[model samples]
Target: MTTDPPPEPNREPTPGRLHRARTAFRRWRRTRPFWAAVWTGLGGFVIFFLPMAPLGKILQVGLGGIAGMAGGVLLMAMALLILLLPGQRHTAGVIAVIAGVASFPLSNLGGLFVGMVLSVLGGSMAFAWLPEKPARRRRPRRTTPSAETPVSLGSGSA
Candidate 1:
């Protein structure tokens, strides 16, 4: 007799569309908000470090720290607060967006440009990412006979 082919070692049945969608939602729900906040913080931190660059240094020498770097420092502080405080993320998201916009004048460096973009994206994502509610399962209804059918109490009167 010819031998049947062996089953694939670790293969499993593919999930249905609904199952796959639900799984994707669960994964996104878990990470999207956290990553958004992280990006915002990272952007702000980058803005803070722009001063160490050669171009930034030259500008720093000319403009002094107050006019050149204060906005970056403020942005960094706001980002750090957002990262450190979980309960205030909504507020932090608002702050991050504001600071990212305001930081434009701080250093006017490439880092500020990159940081502004990232912080805006991250802050908006943080504000907008909401967890999806699970679909509720409904019970099937049992149909009962309506009207017409009469029941006798065994009177035997025919």
Candidate 2:
């Protein structure tokens, strides 16, 4: 009979590249105001795009084209700032809120109110976001009764 080769040692499977990347991204996102930035950026896009869109004609009023463009750009910049400098999120959030409110009168009714609301909400979220504190390990509790406490015997009566 032929001799069998020795069995290989057991080893845990390594994570795939995509899985590693996703995990890293989740960790990064947890430490930052990710959703806030996304909302602000989306709002800015709407405000900026509406002015140049054909539907803009229906919503055009005042000096919206130029002013709206400027406001939208400013809001987008604030979103980037919030992401890049989490510590300065308050300032960026305030700026974004202001820009969003201004867009209403200047850019297609703040992209038909959708962009304005989104920008405001994003700014609010950014302003409220706080870093999470590391969790502390707790000591295991004793299951046995301590000498300091007396144990009851048959409900204190026979």
Candidate 3:
């Protein structure tokens, strides 16, 4: 009987779909306003995890859970608007600023520290960011001095 061929050598495993997606995302560069909006939204989300409480109380505001959630939700909505509505970015920026200011009382000093900082940064960027225009390729004019053009030199020159 003929002998069987030897087994092939092991090969390295390929990256999974999720890994590829993450790599693509990392490679993608976003505009300043986009990054700002993402950061602000992230900050707002962080605030939601903290306990709802007044400045001194810190994370002890469980009694007003609904209110705390409401504030967080509002901030998230504004951030979404900033991202989704490019035309309304200015308006969204204004809202983000308001949310940052409100975060101090709504989520206490912790929110003020995190949420306010991120929101304010994002708001300012959104408000100030301008879309960049693509550069145009212009050909240098191929100009040659006209033969009829006059050139003056010392009268003694031949």
What TM-score quantifies how close candidate 2 is to the native fold? 0.76
Winner by TM-score between candidate 2 and candidate 1? 2
Q: Give the root-mean-square deviation of each candidate in angstroms.
A: 7.6, 7.3, 7.3
Which rank order by lDDT, best down to worst?
2, 3, 1
Tens-place lDDT per residue, model 3, 1-158, is: 99999999999999999999988775443433577678768767766655554655643554334445566677678778877776688888888777777777666653648866877787777887776666799999998879899766668856
Q: Pick by lDDT: which candidate is best?
A: 2
Each prediction's TM-score against the native? 0.54, 0.76, 0.63
lDDT to native, each model: 0.67, 0.87, 0.70
Q: What ranges in model 2 sit over 4 Å off?
A: 1-11, 53-62, 139-158
Q: With candidate 2 superimposed using the best TM-score fit, by how many Å does residue 86's alpha carbon deviate from the native?
A: 0.6
- The residue pairs found clashing in candidate 1 are none
Candidate 2, 1-158: lDDT as tens digits: 99999999999999999999999999998888999999998898888878774655635654787777778888889889988889999999998998999888777789899989999999999999999889999999879988999887766555
Which parts of model 3 have CA positions greater than 4 angstroms off?
1-32, 52-65, 110-112, 144-158
**How well does candidate 3 match the true structure in TM-score terms?**
0.63
User: Which 10 consecutive residues of model 2 have the lowest summed lDDT?
Assistant: 53-62
Work out how many backbone clashes candidate 2 has.
0
